[model samples]
Target: MVKSKPVMHKAGHLFSFVLGVIFVIGGFLATYLKGLPLIEQGKASKNWPTTKGVVLKSKVASHRSSNSNSSTYSAEITYRYQVEGQNYKCGTVWFGSDVSTSNRSLAQDTVKKYPVDKQVVVYYDPQKPAAAVLEPGVFKTTYFYYVFGWLFMGPGILMTGIPLFRWLVRVGRGTDERGENVAGKF
Candidate 1:
């Protein structure tokens, strides 16, 4: 009787799973660690300020859906200011709302709180005026990305690692079911 070799499907799965895990972990770490630094850099840059400004313009726009169940809103603002001995016009877009009613309400509230042509303080990067952000508390929009990234990453690592660990343990028992020795199972 001819014997078919045991394909290492699990091994491939493990590799892909581990890769996903690494991506999640790395993303979380990058977000967490870099958040503060980015904030600080915004503060230190000459171009950016945390002071009040008269909003030149404000409008609501839509962005690509983050998911099938949700939609997103973008609040664009144009503030006039001068940098490096030249007149400049800066505009920033704040994301608000999702498909959820609660998120939509939150976005509406933010809009109401900070209306068009209203005076407000915005945090912006000096190098890029287009890359500006509002102070965190003004809108109360939850840092969803940070939350989502960490949430998946923690479990992804475990989901990928545990199986690989179990496979290692099985291989360590010195049984070969695939013609290759146990030591070469991985």
Candidate 2:
């Protein structure tokens, strides 16, 4: 009887390896490109010089998602401050940009925190006086992107490592071109 040669399949393993590598790269990019900068800005803002500012207008802005029935809410707070005699108006509450929450009360609470005409401490960048924030330094939200990036990295590591481990095991098994076990053969 003639024996049919075994077919060795490495495509699946190669695919896994490629996918894993892509995930790892994506995770790193997310962390470094998006998360790290926000964190750094948050930390730096803590020491920025402060000035007196007044909330000109504070309101809740609603954003409806195009692809879904859901909506998000954020506090639209506009304030005015003076730096080196130049008057500037800014809407930034912090360095991470306006935070949107699904809960309306959250945005409402933010608006309440800075009601119209209320005076607040404004932290301004020395070099660029136009850049300023009401609440400086790192807050719980500051870690959002940083944590998200790491979340991707964890799965990426698993995806990458598993394929690599399997490839190593297969190589160690010493399979012939026909994928037959050749470990004990000459």
Candidate 3:
């Protein structure tokens, strides 16, 4: 009787290792890109030019969704400032570039900080003078992206580590190259 040599396939292990590495890198990349804007805002807050601006309007704009009776509020503020003898008006208070919010109190609090006719320190981009903001800071919501990134990366690391640990420990007693135990097979 002739015995056939068992084929040792490593495709499954290779696939898992490759996918795990991709997931880890992809999660880190997504998180890093999401944080770049916040970082830029931080740097802008410190370096952007400061000028005097007068609040033309300040109120919490309310919106009601058609699907439900629930309403949302957003801080709608407008301010005017002069840069190099040119008049400019802008509505951005921070770099978030959006004002829609489900929380009314938070929006109201933001509105209260810049009451109508109140004078505020405006930060303006030197190259694009029209772009301006009353407040220079990162949004609280950005932290969620960081948390999610770590969440995704954690599982990816585990997926990669398990196989790697198995390989490193040389726990391949009677196991095929696929990293599966074959001792109980026959």
**Number of the top candidate by TM-score?**
2
lDDT, each prediction: 0.55, 0.84, 0.77
At residue 137, give the lDDT of candidate 3. Answer: 63
- Name the 10 consecutive residues with the lowest summed lDDT in model 2: 2-11
lDDT of 2 by residue, 85-170 (tens): 99999998976557577889977988999999999999998988898899898877777777878888888899889766765777
Q: Least accurate stretch of 10 residues (summed lDDT) in model 3?
A: 2-11
* Model 1 segments more than 4 A misplaced: 1-52, 63-70, 83-102, 122-142, 167-186
Q: If both were scored by TM-score, which would come out higher, candidate 1 or candidate 3?
A: 3
Please give the RMSD to the true structure for each candidate, in Å. 6.1, 5.2, 7.9
The digit string of per-residue lDDT tens for model 1 on 1-186 reads 634434467566767787777876776774576443443443454345554456676655555555666566655556665445554566543322222332445445656666767866665556665455554322222344444556667777777777667678667876554435556546
What lDDT is reached at residue 73 by model 2? 92
RMSD of 2: 5.2
lDDT of 1 at 25: 74
Q: What is the lDDT of residue 52 in candidate 3?
A: 97
Q: Rank the candidates by lDDT, best first.
A: 2, 3, 1
Error of 3 at 176 (Å): 23
Model 3, residue 66: what's the lDDT? 95
| TM-score per model over all chains | 0.54, 0.73, 0.56
